[model samples]
Target chain A: MGRQYEIPIGAQHISLLEPLHFKFTTENEKIVATEANVYYVHRGIEQACCSKFKFRQVSFVVGRVCGLCSISHTTAYSQVAEKLLKIEIPLRAKYLRMLVIELDRIHSHLLCLSHVAENSGFEALFMKTMQYREFSMELLEAVCGNRIQYDFSIVGGVARDLKPQVAQSILERLKKFIPQLDELMDIYKNNWTLSLKNKGAGAITKEDAMRLNVVGPFARAAGLAIDVRNETEDLLPWKQVGFEMITETSGDVYARNMVRLRELYVSIRIIENIINGLPESALITETKAFPDGEATVRLEAPRGELFYYAKGNKTQILERLKIKAPTFSNVAAMAEAFTGNEYGSAPAIIASYDPCLSCTAR
Target chain B: MNKVMTSIENLKKDIGDFYKPELHHFMVMNAVEVGDQIEVQWFFSDYAHPCDTTCFYTLVRPETEIPSIKDIVASAWVAEAELVDLMNIKVENTQKGFVLEPDFESGPLRKKK
Candidate 1:
């Protein structure tokens, strides 16, 4: 047997946006096993939602779970609370919700792509991707008044209405973004350095992916064909909004990037449809009733499926609030990916998973 | 959603019969603290029809040892570990401090009187 050594890569690292610690046991240059510690940023939001916040206020609080996919957290929590209240929001509200979520998905995926580039040692590509990513950020700030952690979603409906001028500006921005996204996709597909570094690295077979219960773009990359947007038609008219599930077969870092790049186009299309067919109605419903039962909600966040469970008792505070973030489910798969790979490729592999440790810890 | 209530003893058999990798995708394993017992639910869904969920739930005392589903679903280890640190529920084969620091003694998610 070859001599084995251990390398510890960060509870803090240059490549990670959020804190996650990994201890890899390497035989020579290849990783034989990996152990991940992901709860460095837990803030006890679940306990706070049940003990401190009211049913209505919990939506805004849950949005702080992760800045990248705050909308997913709030949307999932609100849907559960809405279920307990037995209220169907206005059609306009649903369209508005869909619009912002698609916007969030675009920005999140772009950030992950940029980080992948940076970790792959392509600094210029990283800068270019980040430069284009700002457009989505600007659009989000224009619509929600804040770039990150935007408190745009409320229990019964949205907090603010999308004015005509704002919708026009968003459409114009999206049109300009399409060609740039196309160029980025071309660069990612044709770049030799990126493909060599990532093409077959950290790959998981379809059977292993299913055994590990992987979700989100990572699973889809491995030919899992599991997307909550395609499944949950009753929650939102994703079909009417031009939603499509993009999948790739290889399940490597490169395939994962390809999946994200294609999904950006899908998200852009969904946003355009929402803006075109936006209905006119009240932003919120008039309901003062308290929550009195339990409900569960699932939504497709950028990373994967986000799950929320809420229990209420006609009181100001909730009885329990459970949030199972996408990264939480993908942790095992992340560790599995680390095994049977070279230690040099660790950063890129972890980045390819696009883990949000804050979301997992919460 | 289809719900199947089973005891800790019958969990392995029930899950073995219900879970088919080609048919059902394991979604999540969730634990909630009820009045005197903890409710643990194992959720699985079909990829073709996402709304169709098959849930296996069992209620046990906080001190009762629950069986681990890692043999059935490998990804369940993460959630099972979290339950040990958060809800203080004992599972058959899970390590502590997966989330909470080793120096910390109390489960953050436990209800305080």
Candidate 2:
């Protein structure tokens, strides 16, 4: 009297952004089970890296771990290397790192929201969000010399300091995004169609969410109250600045959207704080020599927590670099969250978690 | 405690025989180089599996030989292989049995190379 069903989302499809196979076992339109077949896009990134590159050079290399999270990758990597070397970067350098990383978070979250809008057939919102994103992208290019791959963080410090004029100009640009983000959030909240589509979709209980160790905005939306920045005292310059961790008890698509929108403002405030109270000191180290040791470093990326372990043998080449990116752990939670969601709402629900397959596959 | 060591030692003792052999205690681990020797410290807890730290006692093996802990830990096998691949350190008797083959011409991080 028992029967089972299996349907495969094959890897060969043009719409599939990365090479991954999902075997969805379903009963009618309800997903009963999901089996993920990854490793298709596994490029042996961990296998390929070794002592051949200097700590500074490795920043650019690991920055490719995910375009959406390049800042997080480089920041974590640099922090680990700096810890190993026992070097305290100038206070200005730390603030600069905070500034750039938070900006990256803003761009990443907006991009995710825009993609969510696009998936939900809200074309106008998508176009408008993209137009707003251009300003942030341009700001990144103006400051760090590249749009996506910002080769900013060096082992001891940043490659360059934010010039006063550049900082002022960037502040003006950030001000322009505030009203726009507010308008977008208002639309998401008030739009009947969007609300009906997103509300109560892919909801998870707070207990279940905590038991699964779900992180980033998803867990917060469910009231887990975990943020790498807030959890670790050593992690932030929080006392000098102010921002609240946004939470929503619903834990649905709507909750996730609100948390992310609030995070955009939080990121902007953090950047503003860094610029205003920036310590006057050197940004880059005078010596390029690295120390012989190993260190584990963790940082709050736009998505969630990222960790890196590095070893150096007192040479230009690093002894080893092993990283654990957020997408790796978040994907499992995504699969779990996907259950009971309508098939038609799958793309938007998936986008709600902001899947960066490159981060996962890399 | 002695009980922890006895349990770990029961698995393997040779420094080069187990495959990515790790013991999780629910905390974190970092490898620190002190003078001429390497010291790997485990920051562990009694809870939180998969994501938390485990107390790992390992030996460098030329081939895979680490015993199965699937009953205890869910994703230890793949995680071990990842560590071996990234660090070029070996663990013996793993699920894969053999680590990635050393077909690449150069060892980028090893000083002897």
Q: Which candidate is the best by TM-score?
A: 1
> What TM value does model 1 have?
0.98
TM-score of each: 0.98, 0.81
- Kindly report which residue pairs in candidate 1 clash with one another: none
Off by over 4 Å in 1: none
Which stretch of 10 consecutive residues in model 2 chain B shows the poorest summed lDDT?
Answer: B18-27
lDDT of each: 0.88, 0.66
Model 2, A92-143: lDDT tens digits are 7778888888889888988888877776768798898888888888888878
Instruction: Summarize candidate 1's per-residue lDDT along A1-362 as a digit string, tens digits.
Output: 68999999997788777799999999998999999888898799999998888888999999999999998888888888889898998889888888999999999999999998989888999999999999999999989999998898889988988988989999999999999999999999999999877899889888888888889999999988888999887777788899888989999999999999999999999999899888788888868899987777889999999988777889889988889899888888898887888988989998999999889988
lDDT of 2 at A193: 83
Candidate 1, position B12, lDDT:
93
